[model samples]
Each structure stands twice: as C-alpha cells, then as structure tokens.
Target: MEKMGYQKNWNLDKIFLGGSKSNQFLDYIKRLEVLGRDLERCVKSYTTSLATNEAANLRKLVEYIGEIRVNLSQANSFITCLHSQNTKDQDAATLRGKVAQIESNFEKKLSKVKIILANTKQDVWESLIETKELEDYRFVLNEWRENTDKHFSDEEKNLISDLMADGYHAWGHFYNALVSSINVNVQVDGKEKNLSVGQAINLRSHPNEEVRKESHNALESIGEEKEELFAKILNHIAGFRLQVYKKSGVKSVLEAPLKDNRMKEETLNAMWSVISKYKKPFSNYLNRKAEMMGDSSMKAYNFWAPVTNSNQKIEYDEAAILITEHFSQFGTELEGFVKQAFHEAWIEAEDRANKSAVPFCAAFPLTGESRVFMTFGGTFLNVLTLVHELGHAFHNYAMKSVNGVNKRYPMSVAETASTFSEMIIFDAAMQKAKSKEDKLIILDEKLKCSVMNFMNIHSRFLFEQRFYEERKEGIVSSARLTQLMRDAIHEAYDESLEQPSTYSWVWTPHYYITQSPFYNFPYTFGYFFALGIFAKAKEKGNEFEKDYLNLLRDSGSMTVEDLVMKHLGEDITSEEFWEKGMEICVKDAEEFLKLTSLDDIE
Candidate 1:
C-alpha cells in the first residue's frame, strides 16, 4: 500500500489494546450488564418510595441513569469503531448485538422513568426538578413532562419499547442487509462490469455522458425489480410508526420529528418558507451546467457530471494542515484540538475496498476521546469530508464533558459545528487557490453540496410529508409510493432537470430507519443553522469565537429557539434568519453560472 501523509489508519489499540477478540472488551460488557441490573433495581425502589421519599429516590435514580449512559456510550462507540474499520468482521457484528441487548435492557427500565414523570402533576413535577440535585437535568426532564397526556400508559409504553428492539429495529436491519446484496451491471471500456450500489453511485460522476446515464438506468431497474420487497419494508416500518402515533394521541406525523429535534413547527415552517423561494437560481445552474456539457437539458445522472475538466487531488497531510490552521482563525481553541486529533491518529482515513463507505465520528464518553471514519480519496471533496467529520468530533468535545443527560443534543443543533467547520475551510480554499481552476473546483464543490441541501433534501421531506397524509387512509401500495415519490420530485425540481429521480423511495434508507422519523429536514436545518452561525462570525469578527464555542456547549441544554436567542439573539421562528442562509447559496450558484459562461470553453 502506498503511504499517504500522516498514518492513514486510526489507533483503536489504545482504547482496547486488542481487536474483536479482546478479553478486556468482554469484561467491559460484563460490567455493563451488571450495571443494567442495578439500574432496574434503582427504578423499582424509586417507584416504591413515591409517596414518602419521592424527591430523594428521584435523585438517586438520576445518578444511576447518568452512570448507565457513560457505560452505553463507551461500549457502543467502541463497537461502532470495530464495524466501520472492517465491515466483514463477524465478531464485531456479534459484539454489536451484545451491546444492543444491553442498551435495550437499559431502555426498558428508563421507559418507566418517562412514564412516571408523564403522570406527575405539573406543579409537583416543576418543584421536583427545581431541587438542587435535579436542577441540572431540568431541561431534559421537563421535555418529557411537558406532553403528558399524549403518551401511552406505563404498561403500553413499556411493551412498545420492548417490541421495537425485535420487531421495529429488526426490519431496519433487514432492509440494510438486503440493500448490501444489490449489485448493478454496467458497460465499462467495452466490457461489462458488476458494480455495488456504492460503486454505481461513484459512476454517476463519470465524465463520459453515456457511462453516467447507464449507471443511473441500471440502478433504477434494480429499484423497479426489488420494489415489492422494498415496499414491504417501507410500509411495515411506517405502518408501525403511524399505529403508535394513533395510540399516543399525536395528530400529525410531523409532531414526533419536531419534538425529537427539540425545535418548534414555526421554526421549521420559517426555514422551508425561505427555501421554497430559492429554486429558480439553483435550476438555472443545473441548466447552465447541462449546456456546458453540450446537452439540451440536465438529467438526474447529469446533475453530478463534472463541468471542469480538472483532476486535482490534495494529499491528506496538506488537508489536515489547511483544516486546523483555518479552524484557529475563527475560534479560541478549535485549532489545537484538531492538531491533537491528527497527531494522535484519532482518524481512520485509509482508502481501501470491502470497507463500509459511510463516514462518521463516534465519541467515547468515559474516555473523552473520538474516532473519525472515512475512506479519504485524495480530492478537495475528500478534504472537506475530513473537515466535516472533525467538526462533529469538536462538537462532542465541547459537549457532554460534565457527563449528564443534558449533554446529549438533538440532530438539528448537533450539525452546527460540523457545517461551520466546512464553511471556514471553504473560505480558506478560495483565498489560497493557486489557479483559477482550483478556485472553480472549490466553487463547484460548494454548489453541489448546497444544491443537495436546498433541492434534493426538500424532495425527501415533501415525499415523507405527503406519504404520511395518505398512509392515514390505508396502506399505500408499492405502485402508489412510486407516484408519490414522483410528485415530490416534480414539485421540488420544477423544470430544473430533463429527467428527475423517481425511484427514490425504493432506495432511500431514511424511510426505513426505525428510530428517526422525518430524517430529511434536520439536514436542511443543520446546514442553514451553521450558515447562520457563519454569517454571525463574519458580522462580529474574532470576538464571535467565544459565543460559537459556548453555543456548541449549550446545544444539548435548551430548545432550538431558546438556544438561538441566547447565543445569536436572532429570531429563528421567522423568515429573516433563514433568508441569510439562502442568500449564501444564491450567491454561490450565481458565481458558478458566471464562471461557466466564458468564451474560453467555446
């Protein structure tokens, strides 16, 4: 293997000192299972003392919950590292199931706490959480206690949580396993070659027009062939969710996602309202790119085709230096932390095959360390990906240090730091570009990401939104789901492309995720939320660093609206704050269009 700059592999040995068969890892799980039993006993005691020593028992229960959380985070984060580093590791897979069972056992007992809080009278509950021992966790406890009547009773809620581990989550795991077996055949250099879904996704960006089109059609055909099984997976998961909502007295499908994101409907409405007005400029960029490629219009396949005939690659060490140096320019301590992540070999960036292609950063709570996973192909896009995952690592570093439930934040605000890191590096790339083409590459890369958040994600959100409305009537057939997908694509693209992607529901994994509902909008929320933060940094200059770090720290402790007001002092439930993000996208698209319209290419 050719050695890249900095060691391409991460140091997981420091965490466990051995691989999947480590005896130390086994001992850790044994200790965790013992703790789970203790938590169950603590819950039992708390329920028995409800009348006499209610406050004191509740405090004791909180301490147990805190300890259990650290145990779960350490174990789960370690197993996730094992799996990502080698997807074919069967022992790692078996250990994941073991860790999951421990987590399930923990959740069963934890559900009792939620139900107890739900039944508590509002005045009494307020006074209970206001006590010295409980005040630190008031935000999370109040979140559960606020919507008391809309939830199930103790017996019903416990049954649902237990069933989900086997029934609901199993369906999700099966869908993932099934998708892994799908392979697409395409013609490559006068020979037929088989491609995995991940490989076919890469071919969509092939400079040759025919290759791009072939890969897209092959994947679409597979979706059509597998629609029946995929449809069952989609319907069963959604049907189970809708049934739970009906029993819980929740009126709309959006309610769970809104509450889960720790955000308000008004804020979601405000963000999408601004997004709805920005499609024309993005569509113009797509049309202009199609023209540059000598096509009358853009298709779903052509959307990823490169307009610049440049093949530029940045080495991993160069990317690391660029990311950390620029990160320091905007904050008090971001740069130093980034240097530690690189020098300590905390990132898994080896470029290899048979490895899971998903990229992420996992945080080990007890160790106060993080592991970043990605196959770092040498490109500007890869550099940005490294920067993006580091942003997530830094967010975890800022949060959860005090080790309580409040350290855990929602998906919406959790994305703030990662997206902000990308913005900082983006500025650095443009300012230090050695040539016009390099600058154009940076612009094109930014526009592609912006377009996805702006247009593609909107289609997913609209499709899921409408699918829920119709699911209330009855089970939507596999055929109707296709049309529903088309309806969303049509509305979101709005004459932007010659042909839009319609078989998305057949391939999109978001619809099958059992835990996260409405997996689409948090992305847009995160993107623009970071843009708002970036715009603030630009407006306030270096002094804004303190607030930026402070905001990341507080993300887990408050509602999205409350966090925004406390940090930026901006009204996010209105259109004005969201418009700032759209403006940044608009300017990027316009700049891309200007650069591509030159006579030199002609």
Candidate 2:
C-alpha cells in the first residue's frame, strides 16, 4: 500500500458527469423537480379518507418522497464535496443555492402531505401504516404525524419552510462566510505570516507554548473585532427559532433537540449526572499533563498540549496499513472495507490551500456509497481521525440493504461506530508500545479523548443552553454572550487558567446552525454510548463480533433505547448504565497516574 501511493482526491465523476456543469447533472435536477411536482399533485388529489381507497395514494406518496429524498441527498453531497475542496469555487456555491431552493420546495410539498395525514382519522391513519407498501416506513409516518399535530396551519408551515431558505438558513451561511474570510497574522520563525482561522485554531496544540498563545490571541482578536456582527448573527438565528417554537406551541426549547436525538430528557440528565462525578479525575489528569509540560496550571490552550516529545511521522499509506492490521483482529469485514476505501478513490486526504477545515464522512443513499474528507498531517491524532471516519463509512455500508428512510439515525447514536473504531486503534497502539514514552503517548491520547468528551463538550452544552434561555428574553449583546460563555466554562471545568476563553461562543460554528439546535451534547452522548458497548465487547470477547455488526446494522432502524435494550440488555435511561460508561474514563486516568509513577513495575 505504501508503494501504491493511495489516491488522495475523491472521484466526483461517480456522482455526476462534469461536476455540476454536466448535462447529466442538469437533467437529474429537472427530474427531481418533476418528481416533486408529481408528488404534490398526487397528495392534493387525495380528498377522500384513507380507508376509502385502501391507502393506495398514501403508499405512492411515501415512495415518491423517498425517491426525491435520495436524489436530493446525492446532489447536496456532491456540491458539498466540491465546495469543501475549493471554498472559493463560485460555481459550486451557486449550485448549492439552487439545491437549497429545490429542497425548500420539496419540503413545502411534503408539509401539505403531512397536513393531510394529520387530518385523517386516527383509526384510518393507523390502518394505512399497516399496509404492505408503508410497513417499512411506519416509524417515519408516525413521526410526521406527531410533528404535524404540534405545528400550525398548512399555510403557516409552508410559509415557514419557504422563508427559512433565505431567512433562517441564510444566516448560517453568512456566518460561515464571515469566519472563512478571516485571516490572522502570526509570527513564524520571526516572520509574519497569514493563516486562515481554521489553520490558526489547529495551532492551539502546537508544541511551542508561545505559538499556541499567539494562535489563541489571534483567534480571540477576530471575535473582538467583529463582536457586534457576531452577536447579531447569533441573536437573529435564535430569535427566529424562538418565534417558530412559540407559534408551534412548544413550551420548552430543549424539546426539539431531544426529539431529534431520539432520547428522553431523563436520559440526558442521567448521563450528565454521571459525567459530573468523573470530572475530578480528568482535572487531575490535566494537572499532571501541565506538570509534564513544566507548567503549574493548565490554560484553555494547554488542554490539547502534547505530553510526549516523540515526533515520529507516519506516511498516508503506512497509516492505512496500521489501521487495516488493527481492524483485522476485530473482523474480516471491517478490514476489507477499510482497504477498499483507500484502494478506491473514496477519501480526499491531502492537505492543500482553500480546503475545508473540518473532517466528515458523507454517505450517498442513492449510490449506497460514502466519501470521507480530511487533511492527513501524518500525526497520531490524524490516524485516529482516519479510523474514526472509516467507522462512519462502515456504518453506512452496514445499512446499504435497508430502506433509505429507515437508515436515518439520530445524532446521538451517529458517533457510536466511529468512536468504537477509535477505541480499537487506541488499544492496539497501547499494546504495541515498546517503551515508557510510547505508552505515555498512547495514554495521553486516550486521556485527551476523555477530557474532550467530558469537559470541553460539557461547557459547550451549558453555553448553548444558557444562550437560548437568554435569547428568549431579548437580543443578547456581545459582552453578555461572552460573560455567559465564561460562566459556563467555569462551571464545567474548575481549572484556574492563565487566560480564560471568552470568545468561544463566537468562533464555535455549532451555535449558528438552525437545523440542529443542541449539537454539542450528542458528542458526549455518543462517546459514552460507544464506551459502554466497547466494554460489553471486551467482556464477551470475539464471540461478540457478530452481535456488534448486528447492532450497527440496526442503528438506523430503531430508537436508541430500543437498540440498546435489545443488543446490550441495558436501560440507557438508568443512572447505573451511565455510571458504567463513566467508570471507563476514571479507570484510564488512574492507569495514566500509575504509569507515570516509579512504583509501578510491569
């Protein structure tokens, strides 16, 4: 694999002919538009009750909506893939706007269908879902009906959907553009150089303390410069959401995110309760890390600071081999998928100018394929990212045979497979460590994961929660937002930092997105969820491999609680279950302490 020099750019031609300008792509767009219109016509033509026609029209509507959804996903994925590689590509941006319009139009039509379903008699709707054609989509239909029950009139829903294209969602795009256009000047080798916000943020973990501080100050300066504009962006986005919630008669803002996560409020509270008890261990680990780095106390920038001095670099091909070897010990199926993802042109792993800063894996339901995006910098963390994304790709592969509608899992469970894959690589490296330093490096990575999921994400969740609570009263000023974020950080982590981060709310993009309200907690939920499953796998040994795949395959078809109960035989809403997960983090921290002490002799 090293000799082959694996393909680093994705083959977009597999999605379309000429990457957005092709005749084939244009024809496909027209077809999607026609399908939307036809579906609308079919729904409008059904005036009688569902029982009058044996749900024939309802079945047709479900199939048509599914087809439209799959095609739209393919189009959106391709345009995003193109835009991520070249942020300045106007053609890709224009196509994305057009796709957004198409999606909004489809949503309008679907809203009408939902209104019709909501108006149907309960007995009739229940019987209609029992039909052979609609059997697989039972959960989907029920969810639509439930949401419609809480919504306003069809006219208002359609208006909201139409306005969101240029109203709510446009603000998110505006924020993205604002941050992307920012370039910070930093001194490198005694020379001033310009770096993108994404590039500068990555420097927080740089080996040099001065460089990390410089990078952190540069990023905070951007927030200071544009504080008012940033405040307006957040205020309006949250304000618009509040207006919709009020009109829909939603009493609590957390209702939608909790529903989106397929979880109950009890589960979230229980997990956080368990999480709070384990923070001391992680704080201790951070203090030890600070001492290892010759510092008395850890600051915000020092959270991701490296513990070991090893500078070993692994090539892209070598990283692939390492991942394959480690995964082979678990199962042959996963090993094969990882190899195929690299051997084929399914990943864009090269580091270049103007590319997106984030790493993600996008799955195309229409083609039953997925594409992963990342810049491979040859670090151990980068290797972990590769395996993490491969875990996502494997999840998509596991559900290829299932229906597209059923394949949509919540954000909470979405990270289960990815984090599980990271654990595999983490343990493999720990076992292969030949020296104390090597083992320390591996332990550092594990402890860093614990700190991130336990502390950093907890602060984010608190910030969002408070931001929403205040946004409902009135627009929050930039200073007020800063204070709120600082308070949240203080509550989550009791570390006395040299310089506290007050601009976290401004640079973090999670607050700007309207589609998912509380995106922060799902990460913490996913880490713990995967940790619990991994613990079970360890206890069951190789015999659990088949059940593991089965669990992944069913992730999309059922609720998280149901999936856990059936596969792991544990109640996720219980405090005991969450405690079991948090114990893993505590155990890892204790192990790190033992490894660092001279009394330990293996």
Candidate 3:
C-alpha cells in the first residue's frame, strides 16, 4: 500500500461526511453558533462576579472557551482544506464566511474576559489563577492579564470583529480564490499548455531554463493582470489594520505583531542584524549561480531556479521512505508520527488544477490530526517541502492532547520543528550525495533556502513596513506598490538581481494574512531559530532528540526569549545566537562559490 505513491488525495470524510455540503457539517456549524453565544455569556458571568463566584465561574469560563476552541479548530481546518483543494468551491467559500464570523465572535468574547482580568483587583485575580482548577492555564491567564488592552470598549471590539470577518478577512479570501482560479498558458517541453497557478509554479522548478523562465513569466502575468484588484485588496486590508491601531491609540504598526508573536523587538532586530551584515555572501551565491547559467545576474524568474537543474524525479513513494528514513536517525517518535501521517492519508499533495500554490500544514487538534497541503511535483525540492510541512504536522501532533490554551503557540517559535525537520532531510541529502555534482546540487538548494529566508523575506518585510507608512496617508496605487517592491528587493538582495521583482507583493500571501500580523519575519526568525537548534543537535548527538521534543512541546507555553534560554541556553535577543545560524548559511554560499569556480559543467 505504501508503494501506491502515498495517496495524493486526503481523507476528509473522516472529518465530515459529504464534504462541504454535508448536512452533518451544517448541524455542527449550527451547534458552534450556539456554543459561541454560550461563551459570551460565560465571559460576562466570569468577568462580573470575580468575588462571589470566582471558583465556579472561572472553571465554567475555561471549559466553555476550551470547548469552543476545539470546535472552531475543527470547522476552520476542514473548510480551509476544501477551499484550498478547489478555490472555486463556492459551497466551501460560503461556509468559510460563517466559520470566520463564529471565530471572530469567540475572539471578541475572549478579549472581553482578558479586559476583566486586567481590571480585577490583583489579589483576587492571582487567587483565581492559583486555583488547582486553573493551574495549567495560569501562564496563559497571566499573559492575557498583562497584555489586555487599555482602550476599545466591548461594543467597539465586537464591531471590529464583525467588520473584520466581512471586510478584512473577506478581501484576503477573495485574493486567494482569484489567484487560484487563474489559468495561464506556458510553453513546457516544446508544447504550449494551459496551467493553473499551482501547476505553473511547479514548472518554474523545471530542469529546463526555458521552462522555468516561461513558467515564471506566465505566473507573473497573473499578478500583473490582477494588479489593480490586488492593490485595492492590499490597501483595504492594510487600511483596516491602520484604522484599528489608531482607534486603540497604538502608534506603532509593529507593536501588535511583536506582542502577538510573544517576541521582543530586540529578538527581531538581532535576527535582521545578522541578515543585514551577511547579505553579501548570499548575493555572491546568486551571482555565481547566474554566471553558471550563462547569465551575468538572475532576473526575477531565475531567483528560485534549480542551480544544477537536475531532472531527478523523486516520486512521492520514494519521498515518504526517504523523509521517514532520515527522520528516524534523529528520533523514533517523530519518524513513527510521520509514517502514520502518510499511511493515514493525512496529506493532500495532489497535482491538480485550482489547488493552492503555497504549502501549509493545518492542525486539527479536536481530531488529533493534521493535514498538509501542497502540490507534489516529485522533485527533490518537493521532497524538502514534504518534510518541512510534515514537521509542522508533527509539532501539532506532539501537542495535540494538551489543553487548547497551551497548544496555541505563537508563530515566532512555531517553525522550530518544521525547519528542524528540513535540516535533518537536507543534511541527509548532502551526506548521501554520490558525486561532486550531486553535492553541489544539494548545497545549492540549501543556499536557496537561506536566500529565501533572509534576502527575499527582508524585501517583503521592508515593503510591508513602507506600504503601511504610505497607506496611512492615502490609498497607495498599483504602480507605487510595484516600485516599493522593486526598491526593497534591490536593497535586500544587495542589487544582485538582474531585474528586480515588481509583482511579489501581489502574490505573497504573508501580506494578506489578517490572522497573523507581520507574518513574514517570523518565518526568518523560525528558520534561524531552528537552525541554531539543529546545530545544537550535532553537539548533543544521540541526546538531541529528547531535548528537541521537549522544545517543541514547550513552544506554546513560553516566551520567545525564555523558550530559547530554557532549551538552547542562548539569548535570541543577542546577535551571537543569530550569528551562529548565519555562519552555517554563509559557509554554504562560500562553498557554492568555490564549487562553481572549480568545476565547469556543461
């Protein structure tokens, strides 16, 4: 059965019968609405009578909220699976809106309770969290109390949530649907073929230079054609954020994202400082890659082209075995979990039209299951994505049985297991290389990943920061956004790109994620954070697995600084911690340069 190529389509019937139109799923949705009202009532009761009914009320509030969280995670994950599988799924789209409203309602109610905790007398509030009933939740409770807003009334919060579901989130949903529905024509293997956005992306990694360039051209054409619509979406979504921040007297845009990520400004700066100083090495790698490709420098299309252009096809079945085999070297528990995920048909890697271009792993804690979404192109790069997303699935699996509050980790540290898994697979690939050329190919992939995390991500972060600054004054036009993106890439990539990108801002999903504010930097933060741990793994040798597992389990329960200190014995706020990760990447780029110069391949 494992030889049947690991079942490309996922078994969502295990989640809800009859897919999106299921009456059973509809019933579940109705029940969630009822639970949502119950949660709000519980929030009011728990907030108003902290003295008389502190013990019973506190337990009720936690129980109702926890139950709601389980239901919400299940409903949202299922519909999102449907949406991504077919962005044209109108039934799923409608259900998505309903689920968003329910989630928004629940969040605002939870927000009100946090406000109450901040206003309560200190001794009484401490006593409530100190109770045996809430001992496990004390950390999250304290976090809420400490971070509660000083502005925004209950009605104001509710109004914002209602508008957010229809306005802010709706715009993001529209963008994904529009992009996925778009079909473009590209010449692949001497034949002109119509491809969806996802398929076009697959061809961009083609071993043929012409294929990669043509595919990127077609994909960018979608961004260009949709530029005006995308610009409005960007402005409106960002406009919503700015208005909310202003309404709450928040002066800085980064403030909310930093707080949401449970990270300090110093930790972020520390990561970027390493990237800023070390950009030249990755830029050098890019230039060397271009030279090898018979070009002086790479254009936007060649930014992610396979360096060696290996036509090696690592089919899905082989990928499963390789991922688990390499994963087992680190730990049996993780390897076993990944194998189970494959056998259980938990991943949707179907190469189909109308599917999402990007990859993600969605955690459904209520069912103790996680679904990974991607188009498996059967390249080594696809295999890396396979391992990376599965790592996210396992992270959720590790913490699945924990209470909902404790399992809700911030995005900052969430990439630990995913990128950590990537290193295991990547290192294994490099070690198993059969020749100089093979080693160079694998090393090139590593450098590409590093470039994405640092230079490409920095360009996005810069664009967003400046875009928000511009959006504050007025609606930023499509031309201006393109110019901003171009300027950012030029600076961040050290002006190495032969033709800097202008359309990245339109397709980059990070800019549109309302759920995670400032979504791009956390990726780099997580990448190098995991890289640091991977290096530690080499030092710890046989003992690293246990420590790594402990780190993943505790990710949601600790602050970014405290978590790293406790697990890795390092301060993420210091340049030294990030410098270690940067060194690993820089060495790869240096090696790539040497290899290119030493061996001239036709």
| Best-performing candidate as measured by lDDT | 3
Ordered list by TM-score, greatest first: 3, 2, 1
lDDT of 2 by residue, 149-195 (tens): 44576677778887899789989878877776778888765778788
Instruction: State which candidate, 1 or 2, has the greater lDDT.
Output: 2
Error of 1 at 382 (Å): 2.5
TM-score of structure candidate 2: 0.95
Specify the poorest-scoring 10-residue window by lDDT in model 1: 45-54
Off by over 4 Å in 2: 52-57, 131-133, 149-151, 189-191, 496-498, 540-545, 598-602
Provide the clashing-pair count of each candidate structure: 0, 0, 0
Model 3 bad stretches (over 4 Å): 1-4, 47-49, 52-56, 130-132
TM-score of each: 0.93, 0.95, 0.96
Q: For candidate 1, report its TM-score.
A: 0.93
lDDT string, candidate 3, 98-143, tens digits? 8888898888988888787788888887777778887777878889
> What residue pairs are clashing in model 3?
none
Candidate scoring better on lDDT of 2 and 3: 3
Q: Judging by TM-score against the true structure, name the best candidate.
A: 3
Per-residue lDDT tens digits for candidate 1, residues 1-602, read 23336778999888887889989999999999999998887777654213323676776677678888887988888887887677667898788788878888898787777767876766777677777777777787778667544456667766787788778887987776677567788986677878656556666666667888898899888998989889888888888898998987889899989998999999999988888888898888888877877778788898876667664556888777777778888876787789789889999987664555467899877877889988775666678778889999998888756655777788888777888899998887788989656666778778887888878889899999998898888888888999988888877876676666688787777888788998888888889889888888989988887788789888887999999899878889999998877888899988887777673552
